[model samples]
Target: MPKKAKAHASRQITLSELVTIQAGYPFRGSIQENPDGDVKAVQPRDISDLGELSADKLITTNLTGKRKADWLQQGDILFISKGIRHFACYVPEDMPETTLAPSLFLLRVKPEYQGQLNPEFLTWQINQAPVQRYFDNSAEGSRQLNIRKPILAAAPIAVPDIETQNTIARLYAASLRENALLHRLIHNRQQQLNAIANDLISHS
Candidate 1:
């Protein structure tokens, strides 16, 4: 028989206390894509509903002005604050020199809380039903619901011990991988069926 997991003590705290939330890079005017650009900018569409951020095919652009750039780092959490659906995703260690668009918020775990709070755990917590409901209720604007910076910073998060957090984060990560694999399998199967149908039509 498998060993049962032990429950760990947890405490509820506001997000601001755990991480420093910063607004995304404020790119001026229309985003002009440059294939030769050095930096890659992540847009709201680049992120999936399952908290996966695609680094491939991102908008590449150069900054001409004097605006300082804050590059996205590994373990960083990107949260969608401008859309009706607020989701959080963790930046993988394989990320390159990338910056997020203004529609998102960059959350970096505070140095003091870094050891105590895991980025993946925090990302998972932010996407949970209860926290999502909080965001949904507090979101403003008529045409499009938006979660203000203050509101996002003030959102509550349950923090457990580092060990427990790591375990949960690992499980969540595995689930995401499994989900992606299943999607690919389904897509390939559908393509196989389509190919068979096309062959039958040609034969007929």
Candidate 2:
């Protein structure tokens, strides 16, 4: 591999290799709602948390069956099939033991490929420049762009070697965490500085 490749190049694997299959998000009106039940549906805004799904992200489902629930698993990945093209992020962690929400496609990987693709890495890649471009190109609607399975599967994937992919995944995950921590730290320091200024002003 070239030198720059080490920085950004990946093995480029087929979508079929690392993915099991795709599930479409149900239309908002199509999701069966229960008046007495409590389920917090996840929308595009819920894809953050370093690409991890939060417990509150689970939405209510009127569908009564085990198979539909099986679509979400501990390590299964959630991808936004609609909305902003570049907003196609993945859920990094396990799905909460709750009803899976609609408007997002769920991609469950087999146990054999667990370590091959990290949810965080895949999420970052999906939101990256190249893949985002594919989504932009594939989107066919005026309001919210719609991304089909073919578009996702055929999107050029620059999957580097396993080792490199692992590194990239780790780096991606760590950077987000560190950035969040840094932001909090900065906020706290700012508050302290403001307090000190307030004391000086009061004394003066």
Candidate 3:
């Protein structure tokens, strides 16, 4: 008979063993602007429901020089840490190039050397509930659980074949497009309703 599958692999990798990021940046909301074009700031609320660096709420600040420069960009992934209790999250959508303002760990996928990991899949994996629990277990501080890059990378992870990873990434990309479409539809409907209400009030 063929060799049966083992109950478990003799070895397993952890999260902290994945990539390289020492710690996450925690951008507070207080530093965030209230949505005027003149200000410059970012906050967790700026993270769209779809997990992306959504449109930002600008705030008053003299944040210039190098600080004024290194903003966010499209296709960049960021990890949200701090202030929140014990959960791992990411900005799912791509922001305009040069819009950095969140306390998030900017993730750059060196595609040339990710082994068998699709960066998109990894994004989902990290934000996964089970994986979040791993971080929770390793949390150090009292209120905010801090996990350094080493520990974050050492977390256990099992990746499938590259073909499979690519397949998952394709699906994920499709889903993201769908989500954006849905959002646009909703927004258009809301606009229509508001216009109708305004007309009725004005005509009355």
lDDT value, candidate 1, whole model: 0.88
Give a tens-digit lDDT track for model 3, residues 119-199.
666666666677778778876778666665555666676666667667666776677689989989999999999999999
Which window of ten consecutive residues has the lowest lDDT sum in model 2?
A: 63-72
lDDT of 1 at 59: 85
User: Once model 1 is optimally superposed onto the true structure by TM-score, how far is the C-alpha of residue 198 displaced, in angstroms?
Assistant: 1.2
Inter-residue clash pairs, candidate 2: 10-159, 10-160, 11-159, 11-160, 12-159, 40-59, 41-59, 51-92, 74-94
Tens digits of per-residue lDDT for model 1, 1-204 = 998877678999999999999998778865679999998888888888989888777988976546676788889999998866789989987466788888899999899986888999999999999999899889999868899999999998998889999998999999899999999999999999999999999999
lDDT of 2: 0.63
Per-residue lDDT tens digits for candidate 2, residues 19-138, read: 765664344465665655544445556666345444464456554434545335555566777676335445544445344445676666557777776655666677778877778877
Candidates ranked by lDDT: 1, 2, 3
Cα-based TM-score, every candidate: 0.93, 0.70, 0.61
RMSD in angstroms, all models?
A: 2.3, 4.7, 6.2
CA shift of 187, model 3, Å: 1.3
For each candidate, what is the lDDT?
A: 0.88, 0.63, 0.55
